[model samples]
Target: MGKIVISSNVTLDGVVQDPDGAEGFALGGWFHRFAGSKDLEDWAARETAELLGVDALLLGRRTSEWFESRLRPGGGAEARVSPEWADRMNSIPKYVVSSTPEPPRWNNTTVLNGDAVKEISELERTVAGEILVYGSYQLVRTLLEQNLADELRLVVFPVVLGTGLRIFDETGGKPLRLVDTRQMGDGLAFHTYEFVRG
Candidate 1:
């Protein structure tokens, strides 16, 4: 079975929406303004390593559009991810959960246009490594609600946007076991949690 890893950079208030300030949210680009020292480099390195290990990606339509525009060749002037991370994003198989197939013209991307949980469940049986997730807030909530997420790796930045779309919003409050926690230099903290299933 494959592990589903939900990775994101969130604020102190759990706001994950438009961290890059793309969606015109009031608190958009909140994540980049944090004045961190060495933590930012470490966080990028860790994400690159994680991407190297993953076999596939599961993304919602919005996130899919973001990645397709940024990660593909000749794109990404705003949020230029590292070349190593970009390689994995472009090379790995991406199963995007969307309402239409006309979008996200990135290579090696497959659109899953039906029930997300059911499709992801079926996908788990076919992959051996990680089914990595990034910036898919609604999908993350569903995964947590249905007890499907295996691990959550959050890079918590030092900022609190008190009123934006939260990552844990409306999530059906599931307990999780802390697998690992570390200081990524500066004030940033990296936390890994595994979903607890009884």
Candidate 2:
């Protein structure tokens, strides 16, 4: 089976929303504001390089909306990715799990609005390399409930958001095994964990 990897930039309190200042929320831009040190940038670049191994990207509706509004115009987060990085991203396929989206405008993107497991399984059979999930709290919750995710990669920033969307809000208990952990100079800690199945 193909591996399903999830990569996210979360706050110390697990908040993952508006890390890039796309939203007007005063609390939304924590990732860039508090974590823009050279050490953090270098670490993020390294992580981005590693995450590029995925054959495709899986995003949730909200994230897709935010990205589309800002990045699609060739500004904000989109601008952050250099031409080289953009070229690499454009080459990979993207699957957006959304119900209200009217198709994706980005190149090589597919909008999915059905059973998450079924769709992801189909993609796994056809796509090469790993399938990476980003900024989809809802999708990630479902994947965890269905026990579909193979690996979880979290980049925890040093700052704390008192309130926001969290990645581990799912009920019940799902066990995980730590595969690796590293501390970057920017005070961001990278944690890789594998779900421990029964």
Candidate 3:
């Protein structure tokens, strides 16, 4: 069985919106503010290590489109990251939960056209390792609400953005067991929590 892990970079205030400033949110680009810091570099290294173990990626429709636009080969965004990292991202098996019939344009992507919970539940049964979810807020909420996600890995930055779209906005209360915690440098706190399912 695959462990559905939600790996997110959130602010101190639990805001998950527009970390990269791509969406034009008022408080956007909070994540890149610490781009060149030693702490941020350490935190990114840890994230890279975690990503190395991921077998697949689960994404929402909008997030899928966003990645397609920014991360695709010859798309100009590949210049921002290392070749190996870009290759891993491009080659990973991706499943996008989309109601629309239009297929996702990213390489190695498959559109899950039916019910979100059912599609992901079936995916969990077939996948053998970690299925990482990144920047898909709506999909993350659905997974939490439907009891589909297995773990939550949050890299909490030190800064507090006053307001933004939070991941747990409309999510119901779900118990979590702390599995791991790591302080990356002085600014980043990495925490892993396993969902307590009955």
Candidate 4:
């Protein structure tokens, strides 16, 4: 069985809305606000390390589209990251959870339609190794609620946005077992939690 891991960067307040600040959310871009800092570089290196071990990627349609626009080759953020990183991202298999009938246009992407939990559970059974999820807040909530996610790796930044879209917004009580915790840089906390499954 595959491990479904939700990996994301969140602020102190749990805000995961828009780290790049490209989105127009009132509190968006709290993540990139610390550009060029030693802490930020540490955080980026940490993310790169995680990506190195990732077998496949699971994302929401919107997040997938966002990556397509900003992380793809020739995209806005493409010029900033290493070419190896970009190539690895493009080579990995991506599964998008979307209700839309139109297929995702990104390379090596598959769309999962209908019944999120069931689809993901089947995905878990079929694929081996780590299936990392990034920036799919709603889908992450569902996975948490339904006990489908195996692990959650959160890179907690220092800033708190007071108010914005949070990852655990409406998620009910679910206990987690801390697998690992470490400080990446001066301000970032890297935590890994495993969902307590019966």
**Whole-structure CA lDDT of model 3:** 0.86
Over the full model, what C-alpha lDDT does candidate 1 score relative to the true structure? 0.84
Top-lDDT structure, candidate number: 3
* 82-113 per-residue lDDT for model 4 (tens digits): 66667777788999999999977889999998
- Candidate 1, 79: how far from true, in Å? 8.0
Give the alpha carbon lDDT tens digit for every residue of 1-198 in model 2. Answer: 577898888988888878877667678888767775775767657666865666778888777666566555555656466555656666677888887748677778898887778997787777767888877888898888888888988888888889887888764597889999988775778899998888
Q: Which structure is stronger by lDDT: 2 or 3?
A: 3
Give the Å shift of residue 193 in candidate 1. 0.4
TM-score of every model? 0.93, 0.87, 0.94, 0.94
Taking every candidate in turn, the Cα RMSD to the unseen true structure, in Å, is 1.7, 2.2, 1.4, 1.4
What is candidate 4's TM-score against the reference?
0.94
Task: Point out the higher-scoring one by TM-score: 1 or 4.
Answer: 4
- Across 1-198, the per-residue lDDT of candidate 1 in tens digits comes to 999999998998788888878789977997768846477778788888988988999998888887777765667533546777887788899998887757558888888888878988998889899999998888888888888889999898899878888878887558888999998878888899998888
lDDT of every model, 2 decimals:
0.84, 0.78, 0.86, 0.85
lDDT of 4 at 143: 87
Clashing pairs in 1: 21-29
How far off is model 4, as Cα RMSD?
Answer: 1.4
